[model samples]
Target: MASVNEESVRKIIQYVGGKNNIKAGTHCVTRLRLVLDDESKVDKENLDKVDLVKGFFSANGQFQVVIGQGTVDKVYDVFIRLTGLGEATKQEVKDVAAEKGNWLQRGIKVLADIFIPILPAIVTAGLLMGINNILANPGIFFKNQSIVQVYPQWDGFANIIFVIANAAFTFLPVLIGWSAVRRFGGSPLLGIVLGLILVHPDLQNAYGLAQARSEGTVPVWNLFGLEVEKVGYQGQVLPVLFASYVLAKIDVFLRRHVPDNFQLLVVGPVALLVTGFLAFLFIGPVTMILANWITEGLVGLFDIAPIIGGAVYGFLYSILVITGMHHLFLAVDLQLIGSTNSTFLWPILALCNIAQGTAAFAIFFVARQAKMKGLALTSSISAWLGVTEPAIFGVNLRYRYPFFASIISAGIGGAFISVLGVKATSIGIGGLPGILSIIPQYWGAFAIGMAIVLVLPFLLTWVFSKFSKKKTEAELQ
Candidate 1:
């Protein structure tokens, strides 16, 4: 590991308007997140020029500087030392930054904070699902049968792989519960227990309840004369999030009021009982309904006009990325894949990512400065690998026109893919490698759509760059 760079940390503080300007600071996997007292004081141009700073953006009221993976911690250490503020946890920093947002923004930030920690697990599971899809695809290897079907002897092996791939999503509520309670400064074990209760074996599996509800055969439990649905919260995001928040509050309150001698035994049991009842009686049902509606609404709109929906989504997706709210769609994407076995949104997202990468590549050729060209090349590669923060903030957005050019190109490519009905069977990455997640039947369409995304943005940005250069020269003459 590299040691903390004190000089770089000093420049970061100065460029961000000094330690006094930052109310709170913390680092995540790849960025330094700071709640700034005055946004106007930030010297973005100078900040970007700082050594080791990849890019910067303000989202959800936090001024974020991208430090890349692994290096963020070292920089964060120096930052804490320089600011004289004690080291803060990621959740604490999120809380401070969240304080500046309106109700909706704060709500989204809370979700992001809760989910971000567990994204690596979800993403890894998604990639494994993609691999499993290939293994199960009949057209890929065997003639008229999947690999598992063709080789009965290998069935057990395939099933084990499937279980490993499915574990994260199948018990997602537990992960969310654990993370959410910790974020709220409560006992994680109790949160995990609450999560287990939500997804107990005796309860009806959430996925199956959809079918059961349609058949009018869904089971119900009588809890103190109240009829409660016996549904497991498997793969659920919102319900567990709400339940954990309620649990944390109840736990904290009980500890404060309970006698010290009896606190250990009384607080845990009472908090769990009350929180569980509330979760089942109100919070779980309400949030699940909201999650279902949001999922159905997006699916419904896409069904209404696939091409238009794809175009609109691709055009606006980068904006969501800029605001750090893109994680909001992870649950929806997972749900769509879990229910329908495919998602149109993932294909469109792939094109949008490729389009941004292509725009950055064009900037590489057009840039007058060698340093700009190097940044463009590296950021473009990063974007192609499904990480677009570098390309968007470091290169394309910095150039202004390249950003718009990429958006337009992405919209057109997204519409093309939508018209072709390209659907991904899984959701792992979102660029060149993302094609691995697409259904085998739509692989050809995905390739063609990606080609258009790659070329069109490069051509459009290159042309715009030439015109801008000529105009500048003419103005000087």
Candidate 2:
């Protein structure tokens, strides 16, 4: 990719139907945003295989090719030269794309806007937790032993890593509160304060409430003759999101109505006091009940019919990624991990990723085109490493059969793993190395699930490709 040159640019042009198919062209920080006259004319199989081309996806009406940040501009320069297409601004492309999404897609994009900013924190914590899981757990690293179990002296080191990673999960509500409120144009500092109150030390720890309740030690604040349980909202998602929405509205209304001279005095303190009081007295209790209902409903469904649950989720997860609805699940996954110490959904996500990657891998052996073969191989490897966009948009979805083969394979594997009760200790990388994040005892079950995904995608894709008349005719041509 570092050595990408004019030849690479020309190759990209060739893959996108020799530039004539392009209606408008532009570059973003990391993507080539092109509106194509006829989207199907672009050769997706070859596009991803183009030197330095990372991935491509058709969103709204734009066929966007992701070609890394530093490299994309260079590629776009050559693209402009070779195609003789008039340059379009990135915003022009966005406006065009923006005009095309449905209400659901637009809604999910808003969720994406809220979650994407916080991803680095969550992803880092998830990865660190995976490393710490290996170090702290028995039966993972050294044949039924942990680093602490053997060294004993290194216990603090492992515990320290856990402490670091667990901090993120423990205060997940705060992170969401800040991000969500900011997205809604509220004071982010106030969001942080509101979030802090949800996890205040005076309240009974949310996770420890059951034990505290059993011991009759749960704290309560008595107001007149009434009593309110002093319960904290640790890693709860819905409560924070709902409360943040209310906070944003309150801040906006106060700003509009309050007099400028007294606004500083009235707005900040009033907003803080009202939002905090309402969040604690009403919003907290209501949303916490609603959130628990949702959490328990999902848990009950999966527990009652894990195989059916897994199969349905696995089949749709990659599709969710395409629609960008998957961001919503990150919040849910964190909530589950916080409340239950594990999530059943993330393991299925890993399997779906593997299925997508392996499906693209099957294209390597089946295709005759050097470009398609190369792209398939690279994207597949990228998918195995946890980034599935390349394999999905670059190779599998382009080939149609490979994409279908993958999801079906994922469905099968998901059912198997779910039936076996495979679960993740924390959200982490979502492919082969994802095994490192699995609860150690479920490692064998996950492996068996992987075998199903690996073998099925390859076999199914190979068979399906045999019937691909278009690819076959293209190869013969």
Candidate 3:
């Protein structure tokens, strides 16, 4: 551990162009989000060579360094100290990175913590609903009334899993917020409380989103005739989070100051009410507006020239998914669900991602080295299921050819899907399975787009890899 601190941390910072080059940083379960001032200054090849840096991305003005979870905080700490960020101010105290607890081990731990625990919730709901669609409509799966009766076709036990799945994704902000608070030196439970308030069923029902839309502002309740308007907060990351962060700091400060005799009564209640109210009124709305603005901008782009824009979007989209920047697009799903009960982005994204995976799969089939082939196979399988970090970071980024092939293939697929004007009927899963999201209506067109994404890239990559291998053999001969 001491050796890792002295050696890896310094080398990583130097290779990434020193701490001065870093613009900002935020850690996720397996990576560090860095914004670099001059990306050109960093030696990507050298950085990749580092055992600690698993992968990285430099695009759209964001530079990300993938160091898994254990190293994230150490890297974050080194980053903050070097960058002089997260300082305690009069109104806000910056949260420092918590103690390191085995990065590689914790990186997997965090992934398991986020994914393994929640995957059954996602897969069960998705598969059941998808199967139900095939069965109830009669033809895809045996056309049996008993089957429909057992599963109930529409209102059966499947909904329980579906609820878990949809709820997990829909209110993912709370999960992230809870983790963020835990990372940021606050009570994870308190952050969950703040997140729940925003996403809670009671709060949602009391807020009366239907009335709010009709009246342009629904009254949450007439608090001293203040008329608190309910605003939607599902899947929102910033508002309640920011409010909680502020409250946590405030709570800490109050703990330091308020008289011991009356601290519990005055500070506790005031902190809760003040933070909760401010969260809904100020923090929630402001961040929601910002999130909305980002969504509107992206949606507007698609509406303008889906083909060209989608091509650009598809190319970057693959990179975004790999780097975790795709969360920005998830915000659009929230708005789409509210407006049309459908999200148009996922199908396009799914196809592009599948195309990249297909390319990786092709590479897996063709690569000469046993090591490369194994890496390609592992990553390709992961990509097939929609997790592209391994494919992109492990194989494509290192090999060079597959990487460019993926980008090109994604661009072609994106352009084709955009021109088709395909869209998803509802917010559902993504990756190959997400093709179902476009079912019953645009299935044919969606299939065409999906075919293009899945087939073209796979065939192209096979040809490219085969040609490269022949050239290499010829050179050796």
In terms of TM-score, the best-performing candidate is 1
In candidate 2, list every pair of residues with a backbone clash: none
Assess every candidate by TM-score: 0.87, 0.85, 0.65
Instruction: Pick the winner on lDDT between candidates 1 and 3.
Output: 1
Off by over 4 Å in 2: 1-30, 34-56, 60-62, 66-70, 76-99, 141-145, 256-264, 473-477
Worst 10 residues of 1 by lDDT: 468-477
Q: Write the per-residue lDDT of candidate 3 for residues 1-477, one digit (tens) a residue.
A: 432454676777788788787655666665666666677898876776577675676533346676655767676676666667563321121111111224543333333333333345434545555554554444344443434554665555545645654565566556655665555555667667766767766555322465656776554767786766565576554565477677677667776888999887876576667778887767876876775676677678888888887689777887665544565555455456444445667777777667767777877667665545655676676676777776776667655567778777778777877777777644446667776666444567777777777777778776666667765343212
> Across residues 293-339, which tens digit of lDDT does each residue of candidate 2 receive?
77898899899999899999999999988877887788778778867
lDDT tens digits, residues 1-477, model 1?
858668888999999999899998888787898999999999987787787787777777778888877988889888888899888776677788778878878877767767777878877877877777777778778677888788778777777777898888788778888889977878998888988888899988887987889998878989689888887877777788889999999888888899999998899999999998888889889988887887788888887898899899889988888876777787678667655657889888888889999999998888766556676888899899888877998778876778999999888888888878889866757788898778877888889989998899999998887778874233212
TM-score of 3: 0.65
- Model 2 scores what on Cα lDDT? 0.83
lDDT (Cα, 0-100) at 432 in candidate 1? 87
Candidate 2: residue 368 Cα off by (Å): 2.3
Q: Rank the candidates by lDDT, best first.
A: 2, 1, 3
